[model samples]
Target: MNSRHIYHVDLAPVLGSTFQPTGFPDVGAATFTRFEGGQKVDALLVESVQSMANRLEATAWDSAADRPVDAVAGLPWVRVVRAGSAEFLTSSRLEAHRLASPFVHKATVDGRPMLDVIKEKLGLAKDTPLNRSAMARAVAGLDPFCLVHGVFFSHKEWLGQPKFARASSAVIEAHDVLRAISGGRKSDRVRHQLGEDVGGTAEGYGSVPFHRTEWTAKRIVASFVVDGELLRSYGLPEPVADLLETLALWEIRVLLTGGLRLRTACDLDVVSEVEARRGPALPELDELTGRLRELIGQCGEVFGDGEPLTVEWSSGKKG
Candidate 1:
């Protein structure tokens, strides 16, 4: 009975209506709908592994800080000093909403854009990381994206697209196909959220209409990979390997339990790697969570004092 290494869980999230992913329309992620009972549901188009990483990082930070923070940074405010030189001003707190905030000045340093200067300064290689910053921010109760997701160039892949990235004819075919699909799109309901347009309005500042039709999916399955070998390298305590596997399952359960608009099931059985007994009332979950809480806290410190994020958890009672 060698049941020790389990790393992933498959979750089936049922969407209410169309839910938009963070990616642009060009992605054209594959979708599956209307399944007959027990028809195999493939994990259609996983969000890039990095996306999940960001979610994890963001969750850890948010939990520790007990505040809403974005994983992306906002644009920087710069002022031109010379014809080709600019003085950098303050930028948006990394917590501000944005996908990629490239505040690099048009100015050059050693024939390179100033953005390079920032990248190097932050010790951001291959894009992100800030050690011990999260706990400091958590204590201060201040929110910032870099403190959470770490600073990185999100559009790096698009910039890295090679010359042969798209064949001469493939581009044309893609555009035609995309245009065809982009047209004739309709929605039964449009999601509306209050928004403001300080820059574009007849009045100096006014609210801008915000609307989006969520791209609903019949079910979304998220998979997490466990690094068994890495766990062994740490040479952690009794059945620590098993504990990590169990934690992965709990993390998924907690995320689903978050008030996401869609309905989702933790689908722990899909995670047979740990052999957890599933039920409405599973004290084992709390026990495992508490152990993980202590373990993670001992490591780099767990967000919000060895408890869960966003929502409160103390004395087996969520605050």
Candidate 2:
């Protein structure tokens, strides 16, 4: 069977002020709609490419159209930016596209399609279209490890968290095993203190930390074993397994950081007990909220439903 192809596009550059004339807006304040099987599911506001470009264009044209030609000349030139792109091939629909794309396509992961796994695991109807709402809920409910690892693998950094260092180490370790396995080489140790196959160690046993704080060369080996076990258990392909590991790391960071932005608008002057009951402080609260909301909305426009040029939805869910 042919593997499914998943594509990732970075919309940051396309949603910038320079792309405004092309109808992109500031992504933070746009509403997003997710669709499955041509039906709408869940919707949310997020930062998207289209919204960001549109907003920037509108602001410039509305305020500067009538200004003197020379006055506008001093303004900064706008340009569309392209962040990065990656492609993966897998068997499972959910695993193929995973969270990497705005839409999902039917594919196999570990020799089984995602739809089949969903039916087996979640008891979802075979004929049902994975709509946005359902998919979003599923993603939200995914094992924090899988979700965080996926995110981490895609990008080296998340909100300033250092995940690349760990991922790079894992990749190198995996490569070593792949090479040794291909070479029919045998070592004396059973399970090395690490999770990998040592010359003389037992199967499925290794010493390493499962959490990020435990990350180390030995832990990397253990992580590899854990990854293999997860792949076999979940029927995920090697690529998908790697993606999940990265995402798991990212999730940990997100959880540790709380939400995307810190709440810096706390009140002062009141006693501790009274202050706890109070809401955000004045202008700063309003300003930060507005900015975040705007950015999220823009994200929605770029990746949301209802746009023909946009990607299709997999299981119903809004990011």
Candidate 3:
């Protein structure tokens, strides 16, 4: 009765103890508004996925050669430059909101409309009736740039907003705790390095705001509610579903690796009704990593001859 579908996850970050605080200006250091704080956490999660996407941009099937292709050939998904909409994942689906459609009447990255660029790249006639769907799929097939990174992070609530983020289902609660971080004191700076009058007042750059984190120790952690039932309903292949879950977890792993003063919960509390009695409560990530290899094994041919490969979607621990 083991269901690989992940239903819920609980994570608690031990800041100051091991990891320092991690706060941002968007939500402010002392923001108490739930919505605003949620928005900030949502933004972080979304961008983190984009970061993962950037790291994993190399996955595409070359239709011409009937084989896998290079990263430059296409990304695993699209990332609409700065002006394009961004994507966010939730507990049940993926959602998107247009940042700004400035490209509506203007050209993007070139002196032509996006359709024209896609047409030229695909070697299609300018007059070809490339509808919106066709155009999107075409662009995704070739570059995935227009698809927005991590759009494949589906099975959330399918919710989105323009100025605010919507992560109701996935994130039940989030905490951004502040703490005293270690750093250069103004007196230390003036005495050792910049003798007096660095800032013309013996303050130097040590006392500047934003330049140094006032609250050096910050902890950002959240409790999530995932639904394996909903996740499994997406109808994707088992490996692919697991891959998405793995990558989503990997995004956190990448951001919270043991470094700097930012410590995070490496061990995530995983609870699934599938392994109800005792199984799903604590599943090993190593098992999932082993499964991701099927993808590599299937495409090792395109991977230049005699190259040692290590496909690591690294993250840690279980709470």
Task: Using TM-score, give the best candidate's number.
Answer: 3
What tens digits encode model 1's per-residue C-alpha lDDT throughout 251-277?
444543442232132111121232223
lDDT of 2 by residue, 1-319 (tens): 1111111111111111111111124643222345658875433222233222222222212233332122112211111111122222221112322333223223233444433443333334434543433332233233222222232223221112112111111111100110001112344344555533343234534443332110111000001111323323343433433333333222222222222111122111111111111222112323433433343233332223212111212343443
> RMSD, each candidate, Å?
15.8, 26.9, 13.4
Model 1 weakest lDDT span, ten residues long: 166-175
lDDT agreement of model 1 with the native: 0.32
What overall lDDT goes with each candidate model?
Answer: 0.32, 0.25, 0.31
TM-score of each: 0.35, 0.19, 0.37
**Model 3 spans with C-alpha error above 4 angstroms:** 1-27, 33-185, 188-221, 224-246, 249-283, 296-319
Which lDDT value does model 2 have at 190? 48
Q: Pick the winner on lDDT between candidates 1 and 2.
A: 1
For model 2, what is the C-alpha lDDT against the true structure?
0.25
Model 2 alpha-carbon miss at residue 273, Å:
26
lDDT of 3 by residue, 109-133 (tens): 3334443343354344433542434
